[model samples]
Target: MTNVSPSGPASERSTGRRVIRILIAVLVVLALVVVCFLVWAKAVMQGERPAALEAWTDDRVSIESFDDSVVMTPIDAASDRGLVFIPGAKVDPYAYLAKLVDAVAETGTTVVITKPTLNLAFFDTRPLDTFTRHAPDVDEWFVGGHSLGGVKACMMAADEEVAGLVFFGSYCSNDVSDSDLAVLSISGSDDGLSTPDKIEGAAHLLPADATFVEIEGANHASFGDYGVQPGDGVATASDDEVRDEITDALVAFWGGSGE
Candidate 1:
């Protein structure tokens, strides 16, 4: 029999195995670092939580969490109008409960607030489709969002499941100027981010019949319970005052224009 030796090839194989293990260990460490960084980044993005969300607590309102969304329904039988809301980029979806609860209670509309991926709606644009599947009982469905979230909502409104669109301090980058979908655009007078000038300038992107309303003393961050956002103008209206008008605007829109 030929003499058998294990050293040469065995040593090379062992070296390759060690290299593979070292690479895997390095990858694991990098993954952990990335995870920790994302957590920290999201936490840092949070702003002062507004009192409006707490103040609107009503027993008539029922709250539930669905896949990455918060559904606020009236405890009593509500109007068949349904709304899917997208929060502003990096803002907590819960920040809107105060601002939206009164609207839901006052208008008898069922509202679902979709929490976007990493708080950015553009990353996942099918929120209307997702909300529709969850709200089969709604006779009519509308999609709305704040800031970047609204932009994505408008993008998704092309779906047949959506009957209307609402933009809270947001604009449509898509050319829906020809669509017959009812559009209600609410903006803040003092909003530096989605300023009045910018909104008016982009009016052509929307249908000619779109309803545009501006809250007298409101600002960009006034649309949600998150306090002053970076690069936002100083709000001249109290949070409650701003929210009240916003609720009224929504009620009128959903009942009149969006019907």
Candidate 2:
């Protein structure tokens, strides 16, 4: 009979089992930590309660009676250039992009934010008509929006009324015939809602001279100020950082020529 050491096979098996258990335990602890951080961040940074978001309400920006289609919030600013922000469908203007108005205004442009009256799939251009009516006196103009609102910016620029266009997370439908307007399309590589393919398609629709910039890690919702739940979408650095990039690009684009 062959003599076998008692510690050989048994010791190896025991060590393997212990190593597996330790790995499992470490994984569980890491998952819990992630869950805890997400909860804390959402509660402090992105509270869902109506009251938490209500604190941002502005009586000065509120226009009680304008054209039925459009609502504008005029910001205090230092430049003659006008910046209009039209929001996407089913979204409250104050909820997402409101945190960004002051940031855009800091670059020496007046902000005119539009809150849509109707809710649904179909987009209405009537709201823009109301804005055109109000800003007849401004010398220089710039239009921009979040998501579908970016399409509206393109539409406004195409009309030859505005000097430039800024699109945030918007797609260009195949029917882009307006090349006279200057275009700036900004999107993120990780944004699931608007893929890189869609952004490239939109770029093709623009004139060859149009400007395009892509943020490496941003998602659709990240372009706006509101912090989304962790798993719901891609997490970007911060709204302030993204908005700064946009404003600097816009200011530089306009600085060269009146257009």
Top candidate when judged by lDDT against the true structure: 1
Among all windows of 10 consecutive residues in model 2, the one with the lowest summed lDDT is: 43-52
TM match of model 2 to true structure: 0.62
Q: Any runs in candidate 1 off by more than 4 Å, and if so which?
A: 1-41, 44-56, 125-127, 256-259
Residue pairs with clashing backbones, model 1: 53-98
Highest TM-score among the candidates is held by which one?
Answer: 1
CA lDDT of each candidate?
Answer: 0.81, 0.60
Worst 10 residues of 1 by lDDT: 44-53
1-259, model 1: which lDDT tens digit per residue?
8997667988899989999999999999999999986785476245344453363457868888777788888767588888888888888888788888878877778889997876677677453667756667778888889998888888888655677889999999888898988999999999999999989988899999999999999999998876668898889899889888988898787653224
Q: What tens digits encode model 2's per-residue C-alpha lDDT throughout 1-259?
A: 9998669888999999999999999999999999986564333233233522332464324332344323333344444666676765445454443444434444545556575545321345564446655656567777777776777667666665677677777855544445566667777777777777878866777777878888767777766655553433565556556656665666665542222
Clashes of each: 1, 0
lDDT value, residue 73 of candidate 1:
83
Model 2: runs farther than 4 Å from truth?
Answer: 1-77, 96-99, 174-178, 227-232, 255-259
| RMSD value for candidate 2 | 14.5
